[model samples]
Each structure stands twice: as structure tokens, then as C-alpha cells.
Target chain A: MIEAIGVSKRYGETVVVDGVTLRLPRGGVTAIIGPNGAGKSSLLSMIARLLPMSAGQVRVDGLDVARTPGAVLAKRLSILRQDNHLPARLTVRDLVAFGRYPHSGGRPTREDAAHVERALRYLALEGLAERFLDELSGGQRQRAFVAMVLAQDTDYVLLDEPLNSLDMQHAVAMMRLVRRAAEELGKTVVLVLHDLNFASCHADHIVAMRDGRVLMQGSPAAIMTPEAIAAIYDVEATVHEIGGRLIAAYFA
Target chain B: MTAARDPRLVLAVLGALALGSAALFMTWGVNGAWGFALPFRAAKLATMLLVAHAVAVSTVLFQTATGNRILTPAVMGFDQLYVLVQTVLVFALGASAFAGLDRRLLFAGEVAAMIAFSFLLHAALFGGARRSLHLLVLGGVVLGVLFRSLAGFLQRIIDPNEFAFLQDRFFASFNSPHHGLLAIAAAMALAASLLGWRALRRWDVLSLGREVSITLGLDHRREVTRILVMVAMLVSVSTALVGPVTFLGLLVANLAHAVMPSFRHAHLLPAAFLLAVICLAGGQAVLEHGFGFDTSLRVIIDFLGGILFIALLVRGKVR
Candidate 1:
């Protein structure tokens, strides 16, 4: 389980994430959906210890995320932010192999290689394994980055805006991959999502945020209501139940 | 990308290039007395080779740590300050009086100042907020220009003979190189390279930038601090040896990146070292023998290196 106790991120008097207390249980996809500048990314980064919180604490499993050694915490959790630009030109296979660095400490053994291969396969990036990251399309690059994170093979995977720059088809495929990672691998997956309908359709738990504070947190049925969507996004969104899933129609 | 472009193959080619340069530098033309000329030439050769290694390795490692290919230590006003130190020395004591000072004291004082300058620059610019690398580069370039103007201003006040003497010492001509400091510099550079080897192991993670490095459990702050300290030491060693060749670092480090198949420092560092050796030794040999000592080695490196720097900028690679 990931626990955040009054986590706050302040940058010189401008509070981005303000005293947000929450618990994200393990083994399910928790989609943090909010408008831009709503502190979704900030909140996710705080939980993963990517950014130092101005106050409060976060713990992954029973270990304090802030206090644990990075290598030890790395085995428990991994994070992939939206922009994964690299100065060095790296092939998909080479980039994925870096995920094993925390475990093997730069010298990957046979078992590490197997994990890398599995990650490549998981993302359906096997064909593009030899291709450099810069040469790939944005969507493919997104998948390749996710492949690297998956290759980390941690108990918890935190993704910040993982669906950015992804087209509809690729977005659906990526979400399915995230869901599969949760169900099959039993990994705890938390992600910042842009599209509310995707969260409504795919996320088991939804946490809505606006103005650096959590508006609500519950199952999709409870958090996907029309008023909840409006309060979170400041846009009139109609909620519809289709095929036993709450889908938000906000594009109109 | 190609089987023919295997890293081992590139390593062999670069190794060959280094060896070829060393051989030519050692035995280009031996008309003078064997005992006197050979050892004298060997000191210069050794100095050039050590500076080459120091510049290349320091730049590559510094770039790796900062995740910016364009920000060589020299670009960050490392060598500019060295020049400023020499200029101020000459300006204060006059060339004749400055020459009377102990060379080792002068060298030690200059190295100490450069080390102090590096730490101050890093602490001031890199603290409080995590400044972007481009901001750091901009700050460095601005400081570099400031130092150059200050040095130029000092040079203008000095006497004509003193100005010429200072120019002779500062422009990085292979002729009249500092022979006495070769052993000290070479040892310092060697110790630095050995210390840097540990940091190089985790460079792959460090190369990924701050978040990923931290995510992988690598202490990004500690590693960058270590690498920057190493850079300060290496830059001091090289500049104390042969004046500063700012563009030389960019040339060799970028070449190593372009030549290597991976970012593994194990390969990049060696490749960069060989390229640096080849550039310095070969440039020295060509100047000594091919051009009959007509021009300064620094002149050639600066001209070509400046153009290459502009090319890298135009290509949108530096940012």
C-alpha cells in the first residue's frame, strides 16, 4: 500500500500540493484525474519521492518512502514521468536493460536479461527493440518508456501522465497494458490520466483533484458522477452508465 | 547500428589512432642529440598526452553528470579563469618579476584558485533552485566572456615585451611548454582518472537525468557533487599543464559520443581519451614537422573547435 500523510509541495509561497492525505491500496490501478495544474502530477511525484514534499510523509508498503535508501525503495517502486527525453541515443533494448541496473548494479545477469525481454514483450515493443528512441513515433516512444519502467519489475509502478501524446488506439492499448500489469503481475499501478472516460472505463479507483486538493476519491461509479466531474474539471460533463461501466461524455 | 560498428571494433580503431600519434610524436625527425632532444621531446609529448586525457575525460564525465553535451568544464569558464589568473599575475608583478617567482608556487596557487572558482560557481548557480543546465551554460558563457574581457584589459596595460611573453605562455603553443610540471600534472591526472572510474560505472543511470537516477536508487546529488569535484581537479591539472583549450574538450567528447554505440562510460571515456590523445599529439606533430612550427596548436584547435561548436548549435543538439 502507498500512504500519503498531509503531503504538501510548496515552491516559494505557491503551494502546488497542499496537505493532501490519502491511501492508495496495492494491486489495482488508481487513476489520478484532474485538470491541468491541479497538482495531479505533483501529488504522484510526491508519493514516488520524485519531488521533495514541503511537508508530510509518504510510505510504500510498510517502509517510509522518504527514509528508505533509494536502491531499496527502487526495488519496491518505480516512476516514469511524462517527458522521457534522453541526451544519449538509446535503443529500446538498451533502454529497457537500464531498468535492471537497480537490481544487477550495472552488470546484468541472465535473469535480468529475461526480465528485460519480458518487458519488451509486454509492451509489444519486440519488433522495435533494436530501434533508437529518437527514431520512434511519439506513441511508440511512450510505449518504449513504459517498457523500461515495466522492466524495473517493481511491486509498485507510478506513471505520470502516461497517456500524453498517445493517439486513441495507442491510448486504449496502453491502458489495457496498465490493467494487465495490475491483474496478472499483481503490481500496484498508479497513473496521472488526462482523459476522464479512460479513467471511468479502466480505473478501479479514481481520485479527482482540483486546486491542489483532492475533490473526491472512490470507485468509478461514485467519482464519475456529473457533479464530481464538473467540480474536478470545471467543465460540464455528462455521466452515462454503459455496459456496467461509468463513461463520462465531456468532449461535446 | 551495423555489425561492423561494434564497440570493440571502434575501440581498436581509436587505440590504433592513439598509438599512431604516439609513434609519430616520438620519432618524427631525430636530427638533434639523442639524449637531450629525446627526453625534452618526451616531456612535451607526455604533457600533451596527459592534458589530452584530462580534457577529454573531464569534459565527457562533466557532460554526463550535467546531462548536457555542450557544457564542457572549459565552456563553464574553467580555463578562462586560468587565463585570467595568468593575466593578473603578469599585470601585477610584470613579466620579468613574475618569471622570478618559483614555478611550482605559481602552478600550485593557480590550481588552487581554479578549484576554488569551480566550487563557488557550482554552489552559487546550482544551489537554492535546481537550475536548468541551459541556465548553467548561459551563466558560464557570460562569465567566460567577462573573464576574457578582464584578461584582455589586463594585457593592454602590460608592456609590449611582457605582453608578448605572456601571449607566448598562454596561447598553448607546444614549443616552450612547461617541462618541469609534467610529472606532477601527469600524476594528478592519473589519480583523477582512477577516482573518476567509480563514478563512470553509474553514469548510465546518471545520464538518464535527475528523476530516473534518483528513481533507480542512485543518489543524484552525491554523484553529481563527486563528478564536479573530479572535473575541478582534472581541469586544474590540464590547465596548469598547457593553458586552456576550451574547444578541445567539446571536440573530443562529442567525437567519442558520435563514435561509440552506447553511453557506457567504460567505452566513451576510453574512446574520448584516445581521440583527445590523437588530436593533441597529432596536432603537435603536424605543427612541429608538417607546418615547420609556423602556427600555434591552440590556434588550430580553437578555429576548428569553434566551428564545430557552431555546427553543434545549428544542428539543435546542444540544448
Candidate 2:
């Protein structure tokens, strides 16, 4: 379970994330979706402890993110930011192996190697495991990063804009992987996504944020209403239950 | 694809090369009495090894922390600051009083000041929700220019004899090893290596950048600060001992990275250290035997290293 209590982030005069209190459900896929500058990424980063909060506190499984040591939280939680630029030359497997750093401290044990292999297989990147990151396409590189985060084997996974640079096919595949992580692995997966239809079809719960605050939160069926979609994003969209899944058609 | 050469094998080969150069430098053309030649050569060898290790370790850690290969601790104006400190001492107290000051004490003071400068600069530039490394580097470059100009101004106004003494004190001289200061340099260098070993594994992870490193459970800011302090220690040790061999670190560090395909610092550090040793010891040998001491080894190193730096810039890999 992840809980944010009156959390806020202020950069000088700009309040990026306003004070908000919420508890995210465990063992489910929760997607935070909002328009640009909606503070979705900022909120997710605060919960992951990747960004410092200017006010209030965040707790993960009864551990205060502000007070707990990073090493301790690392074992139970992991996060992937949007952009990852490595200065050193690293192959895909080499990078995935680093996901076990909290446990191995750079010395990969046999068990850590198993995790790396499993992650590579899960992302369907076994063929490219030996390929350098610079040699891969944007989508493949994005999957490689996602593979690293999954190899962390944390109960709570937070990703900020994981779908960026990914094509539609890869995007759907990524959402399915996130669902599998929640269902099969029993992990709580939280991600900030911009694509409304993808969030509606894949997420168990949808969090709509706007102007640094949560505008609405509920099941996809509840939040998929036309007014709610318009309230979140200033666009006219029709929500239709197709094959028992809420699909938003904002095109046209 | 050509299989990558095992970094360990490269490390071994470089180690052998470093040793070969060290041996050649130690005994190359010693026609004098064995007793007299051995101690003199040994002292110089010890100083060279200390400076090489300092330059290697400091450059590796600084580049890791900054995540850029082009910026060494020298860019922070440490070498120039060292010269400025020496100049002010000579200008204020004269050569007699400066010479009378214990060399070990002066060396320790310089190291302390260098460490203090890193801490102060980091604290002042790294806060306010802005960990802008660009700002830090810009500030450093600006301050480096300022320090150089101030040192130049002081040099012009000082007495001619004092100026000459300061010049002698400033440029690195490989031929002369102040044997009295070797023990102090060795002790400090050893302490630095111990701490460096403890943080060795973390350096590879650090190269992944701050967000990923923190997500991997490292206190990135704190760890970077620690590495910078160690870097400061090393820069101070080498600069104080040999009057600041500015380009040696850049030359050897990049060479190590280019030669080894591995990303592990454990492998990279040794390769870099051996490269430094080979460059300095081998160059010293060539300067002694081939050139017959007609030219300074520092000039040769700076000349090669400067060209390499410009090449790296032109290649557009630094960004």
C-alpha cells in the first residue's frame, strides 16, 4: 500500500504538486492519467521517493519514505523515470543486472543472474540482451529500461510515463505486462500515463489529476464518463463499453 | 562482431607494462656506485607511483560523479589554486621563510584547503532544489579563470628573485623528488585508496545517473559528495607533490575507458592506474635515456594530453 499525506512540491514560486492526501490500493494496476502539466509524474515521483516533497509525508507499507533508508525501501519498491541516459557503455543484460544492485551491490550472485535472465525473457529482449543500448531503437530501449525495473522484483512498482517513445503495439504489450505483474506476481503497479484509452482499457483504477491535484479517482467504469473525461482533459470524447472494457474514443 | 577483450586481461597486460616501465626507469643507465644510484632512483619511483595513483583514482571518481569524461578535478581549478597558495606564501614570507616551513606541514595544509574548497563549492552550488551540474561546472570554470588571473597578477608584482623561486616551485619537476614529502604523500594516498576501495562497487552504479542510482537505493547526493571529497584529497596530494600535472588524469582515464569494454569501476580503476604508471614511468625513462634530460617530462605529457583533450572535444563524445 502507498499513501501520500498532504504531499506537495514547490520549486521556488511554482507549486508543481499541491497538497493532496490519498491511499493507493495494493496488488492492482492503478494508472494516473492527466493532460500535460497535470503533475502526474511529479506525484508519482514523490511516492517513489525519487523527488523530495516540500510538504507532508509519503508512506510505503508502513515505512515513511522520508525517514526510511533508501536501501530498505529499495527492496520493496522500485521506480523508472521517463528518461535514462547512461554515460558508460552497457549492454542490455549489463543494465538489467544493475537492477539487482540493492541486493548484490554490483557483484551479481547466481540468484541475481536468474532474475536478470527472467526479466530479459519477460520483456522479450533475450535476443537483444547482448546488444548495446545505443544500438537499439527507442521502443526497444524503453522496453530494456522497463525490464530493469521489473527485475528489481519489488512489490510496489512506480513508473513515470513508461509508454513514451513506444509504438501502439509495444504500448499495449507494456500495459499487459503491468497487468501481469499485478495479477500473477501480486505486485502493486502504479504508472502515470497520458493515453486515455489505454488507461481506460487496462487500469483497474483510474486517477485523474489536474493542476497539481487529484480531480477524480475511481474504477475505469466510474471515471470514464464524458464529463469526467472533459474535466480531466479539455477535449470532447465518447466512452463506450466495448467487450466489457471501457474504451475512450477521443479521435475525430 | 569482434569479441570484447576481457577487461581483466587488459588490466593484467597494463599492469605488466607499468611494472616494465618502472623497472626500466629504476635501473636504466646507472653507471654510478650502486648504493648511491639505488636510493635516489627509488625515491623518484615512489613519488611517481604516488602521483600516478592519485591522478588515476581522482580522475575516475570525478568523471563518474560528474558523468562526463572531459571534466577532471583540475577543471575545478585545484592545480591553479595550489600554485596560487604557493605564490601567496612566497610573496608574503619570502623564500627563506617559505623554505623554512616544514614541507609535510605545507602539504597537509594544501590538502585540507582543497577538501574544504570542494565541500564549500558543492554546498553553495548544489542546493535550492537545483542540483544543476552545469551551474557547478560554469562556476568552477569562472573561478578557475579568476584564480589563474589572480596568481598571474601576484607573480608580476613579486620580487624577481621571489618570482624565480615561485616559478621553480610551481611547474612539476619529475627529475627532483622531494624525498622528505614522499612519506606524507604516501600516507595520505593510502588513506584515500582505502576509502576509495570501500566505495568502489558503488561507482559503477553511480555512472547510471542520479535518478537510477537513487532508485537502486543509493543516497545519490551524499555518495556523490563523498566521492568528491576523495577526489579532492587525491587532487591535492598529486598537485602538492609534483606541482600539478594537469593533463595526466584526463589522458590516462580516457585511455583506460577506451581500452577496456567493461563498465565496472573495479576493472576500470586498475586499468587507469596502470595506464598512468606506464605513461609517467615510461615517459620518465624516455626523458632520462632517450632525450638525455634535455626536455621536461611534464611538457611531453601536457603536449600529448592536450592534443588528446582537443581530439575528444572534436570527436563530440563529451556531451
How does model 1 score by TM-score?
0.93
DockQ of 1: 0.64
Q: Model 2, range B126-208, lDDT digits (tens) per residue?
A: 55555555566678778788878999999999999888877776654678755667788888888888876788778888999
In candidate 2, which residue pairs get closer than 3 Å at backbone N, Cα or C atoms, i.e. clash? Answer: none
- Which ten residues in a row are the worst by lDDT in model 2 chain A? A82-91
Candidate 1 at residue B201, lDDT? 60
Q: What is the DockQ for all candidates, taken in turn?
A: 0.64, 0.75
**TM-score list, all predictions:** 0.93, 0.93
Off by over 4 Å in 1: B1-4, B85-112, B128-135, B151-172
For model 1, state the Cα shift of residue A110 in Å: 1.4
Give the C-alpha lDDT of model 1.
0.85
State each candidate's clash count.
1, 0
TM-scores, chain B, all models: 0.87, 0.89
Cα deviation at A167, candidate 2, in Å, is: 1.6
Stretches of model 2 off by over 4 angstroms after superposition = B32-35, B86-102, B124-138, B155-165
